[model samples]
Target: MLMTSEWAIILDEVDELSNMILSSEQAHSLRHAYTAVYKDEELAVEIAAFQRMKDHYEDVQRFGKYHPDYHTIMKKIREQKRALDLNERVAALKIAENDYQDLLDEVSLLIGRSVSDAVKVPVSNPFFASSGSCGTGCGTGGGCSCSS
Candidate 1:
């Protein structure tokens, strides 16, 4: 006969643990298509491992909830739930790191393309001179204005 408080705590912990596992799975899916410089695959593997741990904890919780010694079992389940919470935090951190790296890669690519275009454009091009100077005085304060 579990107390109401104990049952409430158990249900809360179970919900939290389930949410963590689902979040980790989503992160893993994101990493599957990622081929950035960061080791997203490794992070995905770690997330998967944590998800498995959460699942194992869930199984223990289910079994313990039905045991005759409900109080003791509930306590153990709470501890396991706490561990699952910690693992979820780790997975979240990994996901954040991977996302940041992906963003960095995208920015780098954009910058690289811009730089490449700048280098390829000839200096005689009026559009390049105007655009680069922002309509400011070009080539020494409008000293050499291109009127072509």
Candidate 2:
């Protein structure tokens, strides 16, 4: 039976540990994506090892039920889960930001290509003749021809 203060401390530590794991996982995934882009097998292996450590931490929490500090540990585990949930929300936001940045890049490329294509085409002004007179009569020097 753990004292209330001791249990509180344990729970706090568990929450902190959980936050650490979640933050590490998020960083790992981001780095993994970046490394995969560069085809870095060594970094991939390192990331896998980190993932295994995270799994081991989860296993420790699961088997904590058999320990004398079961209640305290379980409470801590629940707090950890809450911390993980918050981490996931943050990771999602980062992913969304990346996606938005990619979209902007694509749109910028498309606009550049479109503008280039447009520049390649010949533009015609229907109101201007080869003699540089306006077709609209006002500037044609025809004295605004009208029958009314």
Candidate 3:
């Protein structure tokens, strides 16, 4: 798709934001936090517990069994996952990563919407479709008069 100058500017800003986000140590920390936590026995235990509960849930769902402790297991799984997510340095890094990602998404959405709006004019409408600045006949040896 051809981006208008405005959208191009916005995309450039988004790219800079992305570069800034990924270049920081916090981003690096966020990217590796999960694996780092899993290497620690204390933190790893919570991850294992969460996985076990998830497996149990899947089994219950697969077999269509009414496990009496399903609710309790789910609660424990959430708690364990929460604990892993809130591990001090990891939490801060993850928050930074998430916030930066949201910003990037917003900018991308804005550019996409603008591009969509710019292209909304029908192909049959020459006044809205063509730039009207073509010096030669549509650059195709007298094809269409307007710059299609």
Candidate 4:
């Protein structure tokens, strides 16, 4: 397959972006925060508890609301979710992860717009939720106005 000069340049630019991502401050912070989260024994216990509760909930889901332990499973799941969500280490890790993701998203948006507004870019802006065809998970789809 023959590759055009423009496509070759685009590929080189993307490679540069990947290098930037590797050295970005957010990437370092994300790794540090992720390590901290895993090193904390308290957080690990909470995560384990949450996983167990989730497994229990799935097991009960087969019986639907008719299960005798449905109410108990629901209550436990809520409790576990709250415990995990409220952890400071987990929260910090999430912030770091989002920061890194924001950098990547900005790069993608820039590349997309450089080509055309009709080009879809996946963005995970916390403040500005897109009505575009890039869903919450950030994937391109038809009829998207994701690029800016």
Candidate 5:
């Protein structure tokens, strides 16, 4: 391996971007939203109940409804899950998360495409699909040859 000045510069720029992102307003918003949700008394109760019900539900699932507690566990799990999912704090947290994720994804997509169209950047949005792939199956039977 050899250290190149160009690589060093790239690494520095990456660090700069990383620092900017960590201190960005969206990052702060996300953190605040997460903390708000985490400290909500109602959400905490719902989350705990859901977790406990889910654990029991999973155990009953292994027995395929034949377990004595299957239906009760399943019903409780669904109720708790619905309550949690429909909570206002959880909704705000999800919005904050999506905003933060979008910002990160945009930066990654810009960097990836700037380097080459072949570079793949995973994103939540589907319209930005990149070209190239991890593999191309060895064509037709075995008679094919790729030019080097």
Candidate 6:
């Protein structure tokens, strides 16, 4: 069984590994590269159009059920959503985020498993015998059950 001090050593190692430069750099680079690839002209235009349609839909809804522009605004909103969906950059960004998330999740699970496995019941006192009291009186010369 691992003692408390042994468990502490495992936890300390996990913390050190989490803080290492390589892991930090990989996470940072994955995020930065993903964002850099997403900052494109067409994707921005689609995003803006989607936002505009969303706002227009909201404004039209205020005019009640018979508002003349309600159906047209709703249709435009759906089309804008589709446009955004069709953009390849959006898909790439999602993939990148998912990949990074998977890596992070794996690391977290490993740490949790290791820490759980390291825990143990406290050790019995070194000086005390399991059967009864401590010291030379335990099992010598009629002091206890043992035959000398």
Question: All predictions: root-mean-square deviation over Cα?
Answer: 25.4, 30.4, 14.8, 4.2, 6.0, 19.9
Instruction: Give the range where candidate 2 is weakest over 10 consecutive residues by summed lDDT.
Output: 120-129
What tens digits encode model 3's per-residue C-alpha lDDT throughout 1-148? Answer: 7889999998898889779767766667566764666567876676677778888777766645367776776677677777777787557656756655555444444454567633322222233234432322245653656434
Candidate 1's TM-score reads 0.23
Candidate 5 matches the true fold with a TM-score of: 0.74
- Kindly list the per-residue Cα lDDT of model 4 for residues 78-112, writing each as its tens digit: 98888777888888999999999888777777666
Q: Which digits, one per residue and each the tens of the lDDT, describe model 2 over residues 14-93? A: 68855654465455566665544336555445445545655655666677667566676456556655554355443454
Backbone clash pairs for candidate 5 read none
Candidate 1, residue 121: CA error in Å?
20
List pairs with backbone clashes in candidate 6.
none
> Evaluated with lDDT, which candidate comes out highest?
4
CA displacement after TM-score superposition, residue 25 of candidate 4 (Å): 1.6
TM-scores for the candidates: 0.23, 0.23, 0.45, 0.75, 0.74, 0.46
Report how far residue 12 has shifted in candidate 3, in Å.
Answer: 12
**What is the Cα-based lDDT of residue 43 in candidate 2?**
43
Clashes of 1: 0
- Model 4's lDDT to the true fold? 0.78
RMSD of 1: 25.4
lDDT winner, 2 or 3: 3
Deviating ranges (above 4 Å) for candidate 6:
1-29, 36-38, 52-70, 117-148
Query: By the lDDT metric, which is better: model 1 or model 2?
Result: 1
Question: By TM-score, highest first, what's the ranking?
Answer: 4, 5, 6, 3, 2, 1
